[model samples]
Target: MFFTPLSLLSGLSPEWQLVVWSLVVTVLISVPFFVRHFSMQAPHEVTPFPFLDLPRELRDIVYENLIQNPSYPPCTPSPKALSRFGWLLPQRPAPSTSNWVMLSNHQVYEEYMDLLCKQAKFTLTVDQKNAKERDIWPIRSETLKQIRKCDLRLVTTSKMLGAEDPRTMPKDWPLRDKICERLRGVQKAEDLNLHVRAIGDPLWNPLWVWYHASQAFKDSAKPCFQRITFSLDTWSPGENLLARNKEGQWEWRCRENHFVATDAGQYLIREFCSALYAECQDCPRR
Candidate 1:
């Protein structure tokens, strides 16, 4: 093999190989020590910004945690209802007090069924205009397009009873393909877990599911555990949701940013956690 020791280190003698290995191990072992020393050498100036509080490396983690990955899986959409209306669930769901919580972004994306369902939604859209942005719902990119292309009209809720409907699963798997592509796109990274939470029943009270999903995770946290959050923007009121200008564009209005349903988030988090633990114990964890 090209990587055989004799081939790879052709010039090295047995003694030199031992020395090189020792050096490699020594280098690995010293990294944390050197890092710690340098970190200690820096002044402990408290920046007003929380992002600033972290080291440059840590700061990046915070951004990826907060800004870079700024989306959550909407609740588990009703896949069972997919066939008749196609996958479109909500044109818009009104905000609710029950939809809020803190969840480890990691745990939620670990094949959490609810988040998986949102992923299913991304695949079924055919509107190419704002398709990517709209379908990525809850998760967003600054450049992401808006959700404008689908032709959803409210057929009465009873249509859900139809059995011939197609699943929200896109007949084509481009959405899933893109997710995989993005993952593979990150070069040389050894560990990566996308923490998309499923807001189950996206068509039906999404906020309620989101709040409960987060609550499930929170309720499971041990006292020793540190809590984390999904983006807080979901619960914030739009600036001008109530007003419309003569020019015909949605106006922006509110100054408050972020959800404040702490009690609700906590409650749903524990309850869902209990249910998930029980379900996963019996079957493979979704």
Candidate 2:
């Protein structure tokens, strides 16, 4: 009689009501288990985000660090300095204390990054390596933890170094010497915590020739990326600014070959700011 009245009130059969009540209880009791199971699963790997066409602040940090800083010091160019032959960076890249001259590697803390800028923008900071070790290898525990969040990679790919061209190599191959790796990007390079940058060949993308001149990164923790950025679905076509030579190393080319070529447009700074805001809402700087 009790079952009959409950069924009449609910307008549901006794068997169906039991099933519904069981389902509700199961969901309430097992939610924690479901969350735990999902959390135990390994997180997926992420592809790098392309920043070839980002704002000036993003692109010019290399310059500000090695060039604009008065104490940063410039790399001393050798008497046969490749720079004099148009094979090097400009004085604007280094601090005034630099010698502006060199054959050997300029001992900057940000080697691969400076190399990339010198190759692309044709500049470096100081030829002198007299700065504190903290300036060069700033990889303190805090900085390392930050850089780790970004996919780490190395440069020294000859093509990006602008040192080797395959046409100049011996056909037998393997005879040409090229060096890669060891330069850290975010850690020791500078102090910005969220500054997502890399100093080597094609940071995340595995398919491209002029891979080192530019890089891509995504704050996977951000709402826009969280799950989508690392997936194959989010990988987009990138613009490479270098040509691969016969030596199999990627080299940096001029910006003309890129997808979004920069054009000469004159505008007031306010207009420029307004337009930029209209477009890139996620940009961190003004």
Candidate 3:
């Protein structure tokens, strides 16, 4: 009683009707196979690896290997590419190319955030050109709290203060103010290594500057540290006062005739050491 395509073929000869039936049967047989073949073409979602299932020690090792000296973000394009109709686009933090594993998931971030701030040595290069902007380059207060060690490299010029006389230097100079402001940002660090390098001839003694900076840090932040070391980039043999020894340690050269000759230099040496050592008794230079 079922009326189907076979009924239409009934008016034809027996052979033709048989042929129609064969065609219909063949299509029916192939429909399910075709459906299954096409459905397999779709992309499939993959489950993330079970990294957290590993032991804590293994996780620490992975974190240590991946977290050292991360690559910096890319520089901005030329002014032409960044400008629109004579107007410059607002600047944003360059996309970081390092430690991207932290963004994998919330659990990974929670486990690695502390290690990133504590173990990795953050370097900040400060000079007059960029010191006016935010001093702590892309660091948050939460991260700043956990920072244990930092290298602060200050690029200074000789014209700011006369090498022959420290008395002529102003107490409230612009460079000193910027330097102090930068120091206050890292007051919580445990170990601080300060490197002072000059851009011109006749490198001046920076003890006076450090003395004031230390005093400012004490007054404002009540700084606490384990060890503080100072290094100078001197050009002249006479100016090589505090050269690091072969053992990669600072050798005290302040007692030389060049430094001891000037009462002002002697006073600065004593004051700088006293101020820094008062906070960090275990200074490496000591």
How far out, in Å, is residue 96 in model 2? 3.5
Q: CA lDDT, every prediction?
A: 0.32, 0.32, 0.53
The worst-scoring run of ten residues by lDDT in candidate 1 lies at 149-158
Alpha-carbon shift of residue 255 in model 3 (angstroms): 15
**What does each candidate score in C-alpha RMSD?**
25.2, 27.2, 11.9
List TM-score per model, in order.
Answer: 0.19, 0.18, 0.50
Best by TM-score: 3
Tens digit of lDDT per residue, candidate 3, span 126-230?
Answer: 555555565535556566566677665555555543234555554555655555554565655766555555444444555554444433322333233222234
State the lDDT at 172 in candidate 1. 32
lDDT (Cα, tens digit) per residue for candidate 1, span 1-286: 2577657666778898889889889999999999999999999888564533456555334333332112233234355645667555553333322222124344333323232222221222112222255243334332222211111111111122121222221223343344333323223222222222222233543333233323332332121112222222245321111112243221221222222222223233345333322221222333
Q: After TM-score superposition, what is the CA distance of residue 19 in candidate 1 from its true location, in Å?
A: 95
Q: What is the lDDT of residue 60 in candidate 2?
A: 57
Which prediction has more favorable lDDT, 1 or 2?
1
Superposition TM-score, candidate 2 onto the true structure: 0.18
Lowest lDDT block of 10, candidate 2 = 223-232
TM-score quality measure for candidate 3: 0.50
In candidate 2, which residue ranges exceed 4 Å CA deviation? 1-74, 81-95, 98-154, 157-239, 242-254, 257-286
Off by over 4 Å in 1: 1-172, 200-276, 279-286
Q: What is the lDDT of residue 175 in candidate 1?
A: 36
